[model samples]
Target: MAFDGKLLANLSVLAAVVESGNFARAADALGLTASGVSRAISRMEARLGIRLLHRTTRSITLTDEGERFYAEVRPLLVGIEEAASHAGGASLSVRGRLRVNVDPLFSRHVLAPRLPEFMARHSDLEIELITRDDLGDIIGEGVDVAVRFGFPPSSSLVARQLLETRIITVASPAYLKKHGHPCTPADIASHTCIQFRDSQTRRPFDWEFHKGRKVVPVTTHGPLLVSDAGTLMSVCIAGGGLAQMMAIGVVQDHLARKKLVQVLPDWADERFPLYAFYPSRHHPAAKVRSFIDFCLEILA
Candidate 1:
């Protein structure tokens, strides 16, 4: 048999059903009725001569054959999407549904502020930003792009460095006045220091301060521990304890406003990197390219 356009169309419906985990949601996304979605799947099953999904009244799961087929189909779908976006020349193939996995801090403090301008520039683009603490199976979750802080561990995805944010040690004025400011990096061990939990390790990261050519590690002990950057900032601002924070972005505003004062500036030479990751580097979709460029502009 030759190629059939209807079969190609059904692939998207299948993708939507598997991604959304239900026919009703898949139908809504594709602008079809639930019964219509059911009919389309039935047609696909008949043409393929295999049950792709183990369907119950309440749930849907892929059969072993369907699992293997879907693995191959995912890459094909991604290629089709990228090709569609590049149909037009280099004027930015920015027209498409862009799925982004964004770090919470960057989403709230950086991207959210400039979103209106970005959307205005690309009227054809539709953005779906998912803000979370960790990057999990972007390909499986259908994420087109992801932005995160720190160096990404080894991965097959292309990670582009967006910025190297300066790191600073800071504490509120009242807290410093009561506890007395530390004079050197080693003195930090005697002072209460905020602790941040590493997402992958689930262990509190050791506090470190950097200077000209020296890196000093200070064992930190604090009354509180937190996973969220916002919570860390909040407690530090309330005169709770000393914290190490980024010197750029909303984090810097506290320093400028005098709500928080930099401590041990001599050891504040450390920098944390931020990166934007995507599945492919070759002929990336216009949406991915445009969004990354937008991030570079704002973070600049």
Candidate 2:
């Protein structure tokens, strides 16, 4: 039997399709036509005499035989890329397309403002910062890393604590002036407090004030309910209403500029943790490590 020269290339195409969830996207990633990608899969299937993909008009999934084959081939594909990188002197380089999934608020206010600095430091790096309401399938979607508030959502992914920010309640000077200042957390209910709905849960968040061991849950209501952090912050800055937000990051800038002022500081003891999550790998690539370190430096 002849050694198949196209075996590795076809396997790579299959891996790309699995990572991208569709052939069109896989083709785009690999610089190939969609029909070309389809043909490659077809060739591999015919050669192996097994069905690899279950195709529908809208979605594509791996068949059992395909899944087993992919499981065997995935590591080889990864290792080949690493070997190629090492041979090309790119193993030590922080130069590759680094796809990061991040929160919308963090992307807009925190990362966007400071991204130029990172880009300057890593002139060869191509960074793609994708902002979505929730953390999607990082492994399946080919994401390098993800930064989000709170804790790790899944046990499968390795998580690192980037920073911890105090949960602070704030209001613009004009809003406080017009609505009268709420000296106590209890008094917030009487004023128009901006509400932020949780992305995972459609329900609005209940405000909480904390001081050491004491915790007070404050039920808040407002004329407007929002699901976006940027909009909530904007409304608070523009004297729309009072809002609770992280004291650091963009909120610190607001405080420095006198755009927003912290209210009830004595009771603001709760700290929100920010984490960086990545899929587990024995020998993670240089680009992934570089990105994670950069995040820690910025968050610090």
Candidate 3:
């Protein structure tokens, strides 16, 4: 067996087969016959002298060797895609299926409303917004980019910090009137506090406060626990309990008529940084670069 470029080509084909689940579906995507696809897989394994797939009539799965090979070649395949896109240069008007994963609240409150402008700017680009509270895997999920909250994972993916968001301790005027305002972190224990427990980190909702130079975490409890910020804000507006909210999420109405009151102004620290993350820079696509620049400009 010679270590030719065919190894890379066959690895790509095998990756497609594994990702698409079956030979027929993989062949459909690759525009190859099912037999051709299967042959490629067989040749690949024979060349490498390893069994890569556990195949049956109805299903197909990767062997341990296949998994390792797939992981190794996955980034290479992505690089090829980026190279092809970059080859088009300015002639390519960002015209591709661009899948993005974003937080549900940000999608609804911020991005969704402003999407028409972006679509109008790039008519050829197809945009699909998958809104979820669950943290999405950009590479694993086949997403072009992901809008993430807080600090990004320490990886090769580029994280462009967009904004320094504000977090505020807030409650409905009614709730505050009934329960009274908490003057200190210790006072939170006496009041019912709304909990956001569905973070990707799976940590309990602990209200963090910054008083002077000291930072403290106040463990409190509420009757309700929520994942969505919009829903949490709704509950707060409806007099649920005191909860900390993103300033953008609560600012408009809170500032206008005061349905919600921002409590403990001095105790609140800055919110986490939001970022637009994508893969490597080896093969940079014009459209992807344009989109990233556009995001930075708009957010800045």
Q: How does candidate 3 fare on TM-score?
A: 0.68
Each candidate's clash count: 0, 0, 0
lDDT: which candidate is best?
A: 1
What are the runs in model 3 whose C-alpha is more than 4 Å off? Answer: 1-87, 90-92
What would the TM-score be for candidate 1 when compared with the true structure?
A: 0.71
**Model 2: number of clashes?**
0
183-219: candidate 2 lDDT, tens digit per residue: 8889988888888887666778779999998999998
Provide the TM-score for each candidate, comma-separated.
0.71, 0.69, 0.68
Taking the tens digit of each residue's C-alpha lDDT, what string does model 1 give over 54-115?
Answer: 99999998999889888988999999989775675434567879999998888988899899
lDDT value, candidate 1, whole model: 0.89
Candidate 1 deviates by what RMSD?
15.1
RMSD of 2: 15.1
Query: Candidate 1 or 3, higher TM-score?
Result: 1
